[model samples]
Target chain A: MKHRTFFWFFLPTGLAMFLFIALPIVSVVTQSVFAPHEAVLKTVENCTPLVGCTTETTIDQEATREIREAQPLGRFVGLDIYLDRGHLAIAELGEAWDTAETWGDFWDRLFNLPLYRALAFTLTFTFIVTPMLIVVGLMIALAVNSLHRHLKGLMIFFSLLPMIVTPLIGSLILFWMVDSRGIIGSALVGLAGDPNFSLKASTGLTWVMLIVYGIWHSAPFAFVVFYAGLQTLPKDQIEAAQIDGATRWQQIKYVVVPHLMPLVTFVALIQLMDNFRVFEPVVGFNASAHATSLSWIIFNDLGGETRQLSAASATSVLTIIGVAILLSPVLVRTWRDFKGK
Target chain B: MASKAQRRPLGLSILIYGFVGLWFILAAFPFFWTLWGSFKVELDFFSIANWTNAITGERTKATYDSAFTGAAYHGAWVQEEFWRNVINTFMVCFFVVLTSLTIGTLGGYALSRSGYRYTFWLLITALIFRAMPPITLVAGYLLPFFEWNVWGILPTTIIVLVAINQPFTLWMLHSFFQNIPKELDESAKVDGCTQFQAFRHVIVPVMWPGVITTGLFSFLLAYNDFAVTAMLLSESNRTMVPAIAAFLGTTYTEGNVMFAVAAVVSATAPLFILVMFFQRQIVSGLTAGAVKG
Candidate 1:
């Protein structure tokens, strides 16, 4: 294709992306540095009357509005919002480190900061769920691969449900079942012989539930990918291994796993990006008290009347950085491939 | 090979089937359970007094003079005007899919055909955009939309969704176009077709399978999104997912959690239907990216 034709073809999408995706990113960074204008206050004193006079301060609403309108992005606070306790919390970290008697104590204090708390959960969820879903998904793919042909589609149909349903709805379905009086919770109570047991009450249990939900929700994706990989497996190689008197497990250990390694990495890369923005499950489970993610923190900040745009924007910038770091490997690979070409 | 495969142990087969069956139940039973529970009264659904009430629908029988009731559905769909949100959702999805696909096909085709370094950078840029959480972009959009007084409208939300959706759409369609063999358009051009004419006449017809697959995914993203719709829309213009989220806030106080339950089921039913019909396209769409990457 001619370069001119290519330019015309790419123009619409390129423009849309630039306007919405690229522009919004720039806007988010700009918004992060600026805080909303504070209301102007004025003090008045009257001494003309012979009696003693008192002064009163009041917000000059018109002046405040004017300033806010004149500078709609709000006051430029430079890196202040990002450095505040709700975000990077440099000062609080310093204070905690200076005063703490032990490293554990210092770390505990650090994690109590809002951004750190969110980051901790987000990282834990991402690291744990990506590997876990990959393993479970691989097992499922192997099992299903062993199935008869007619049954495969039926199994896939069932498997896709958890993945296909809206995330919030999926989590809510599980949440209802895991409620204290619901079937699973009731069954757990029976097994433990503790009528008061509830999955919602404890942080550890809630984390387990969310992680389980994460795996259940995403494992199907890994399964489908691995299943596709399994289809094109080298039959000749497998037969060679078998003819060499290798055991079934040995054949799989050496031949199958190595073949599936690329698919595993593919699943891992996609899952990492998807899981890092974990927000819906937290909302569905209503487990925000026990667990919070970066996306959830931004959502919480943006939810109410105050709007907290600067706070949300700060978190947004930090999240973009996290995504970029996670994605650097893939980006580098693309670059190398382009250069090679 | 068949003889050797048949020599595998019977117990192993049984174990594999057993595990697979267990997984199927784990994967599928939640929707069935929720659907069943959605029909019963709140007491029977939750079953504080007796777990068997959930299955028996004993409370539902007493309350509605039948073992099953659509009262929850009625309450959600009629009383709460959840249908409007449902309508809003479809409207948004319809346009989002249309706009995203129209531009995405063009851009993706161009990228596939081009041999320039910029194509690589553009694809990488789209990848980075795809990786960013939609909520992060929401923070950026909030101020500008508010300033322009364009916040809380369906058109704005739809445009935002299409833009957020463009990166994935481009990547998928680009890959799809790559698989089509460049000789197709080349032959068309040799036969005296202009580039655009070749695309319109030859490439477009052959592109349906891949495009449809991509379109299904685009539909899913637009339909399944919560963060963008929830944040970008207002109370009156909310879509079904966000509307359900709103229901959670009010229904608990009203002792009508069943309304939210009904809304969830309503929201899920379409997706269930979608899978039943388009499972092949959906599966192909999902694996295409992974396999290619």
Candidate 2:
């Protein structure tokens, strides 16, 4: 029988996407509204003693800290998943915001600390990584493109090999390389005068390492696409540019870059959408390194006991929004530029 | 492989080689190290032993056997009984490829020949699914699938990989179909053949290159993916990449023989054959869809 004869063929793919990809996100968004019903808040009350704290404000502060420094085995109280309902204002006019007893005893805890913080972090990570990748990728592409044909092909293939290795493998290489006895380990000890030197766990260094790793993982395809685009440019125009006595830099900047603009725009937007869901490499190394992206947070929650599917789903929703927002500027630019083209 | 006559000066060649050499090392260091580690004992791994050490030396079958045979290297060296895994890997790849090819081909045919605006919608979904992070899917819905026992390993993996791949494969094969001239199909129809028969005989044979290209790539995705298969497979049925990943992710020190084993399965053995046998076709296959500007 013909496949299209069944309604399932056409319907299943779309249905699956909606049921899985979009539904999780929608449920997550609705979770912000579902907030936490009264009974769910009981888990948070239990959490208070689990993490030591005497007063309400201190407890809230401590809870916020715990959420931020989320252990792999962290308890998944559904309430702390929301944003800054930590303060709990009692003296507001009506009965909307007043919570006199516990941090979880909230009627209106929409978007608490962890939720917003993760969203912000995910956005920031995406913002930084995307542009860095584009710039670095273009530079490498240009350099590789200028080489002789034989040299260029070999160089390109070697350079692109990183894209094939799994992020888990890549991160393990990083962990081993930068570990004390590994390549950087002995070198770091020789230079920094300490045997125990792990650049991965250090705060700002982690961000830098992640961006480097992300670029290392990603930039090859961009280089390949840009190279392909460059290769496809009309040879007559290049010959004409040379005949007209344009310098190499002038030819590259004016003609080559313009010619590759469409490819650049496509890569930029794709990378923007793709980078938001950063998880594997971060978790591959350690849970603490999972700080910069929300996907990692969702994965972190999913692995824990309560498994906070509701909160993780909600986080995925915000992550979806964050991805849309991240892409909006690039997308709008692409639309305009593409239309102009 | 073509050596063009425009040879640069020797000094510039060194500079280019030096720069590219460092970058390649950086890119390939992990794979190289994994290969090395896969042969060395855990004890030998920590210590800077003799020059033939697994850290930076030739990884061979003898080293692998020693790692397995001898229990003196810190702890007993980890060896995945390779033959069962080899069979399991074949089953996973074969089912994944077969399933993806069927859906992708049918879907691609519909999208290309259907001549509807919905094809564009299908195209968009394909791009998004292709671009969507694999790790996101694993944590997001795969867990739910596993918990519910909705589908077992072979069925579930085949389903997931096909769904994930259908959009891209369809997208890939659409252009291949478009390249086939409509006149042949029209001529066949004019001679009394139906649309389905015309496609099977006339269109498919002509688009053999497209089928081969898309099929190989779909196979690559199936073979290369760890994130999807990691969440899906238990110890009883791990794919090549995820099986190797277990060595790295574990708490105890294990011998690196698994890395060589994985490299052999995932990249070394099959790819070596594929590349050697059909290098030109494989290159064109990748370049046709992916190398486009």
Using TM-score as the measure, which candidate wins? Answer: 1
Candidate 1 lDDT by residue in tens digits, A1-341: 78899999999999999999999999999999999998999998756676888887999989999998898888989999999999999999999989999999998898799999999999999999999999999989999998989999999999999999999999999998998878898888888899899999998899999999999999999999999989989899988888888888888899999999988988999999999999999999999999999999999999988899999999999999999999999888877877786
What residue pairs clash in candidate 1, if any at all?
Answer: none
Question: Per-residue CA lDDT of candidate 1, range B81-130, in tens?
Answer: 99999999999999999999999999999999998878988988898999
**Interface C-alpha root-mean-square deviation of candidate 2:** 4.4
Per-candidate TM-score against the hidden true structure: 0.98, 0.74
* Lowest lDDT 10-residue stretch of candidate 2 chain A: A37-46
Q: A95-206 in candidate 2: lDDT tens per residue? A: 3345435445442242233444455555666778777877767777776766767877666656655665556556666666555555555567668886566676576666
Question: What ranges in model 1 sit over 4 Å off?
Answer: A46-51
Looking at model 1 chain B, report the run of 10 residues with the lowest lDDT sum.
B1-10
TM-score of chain A of each: 0.97, 0.70
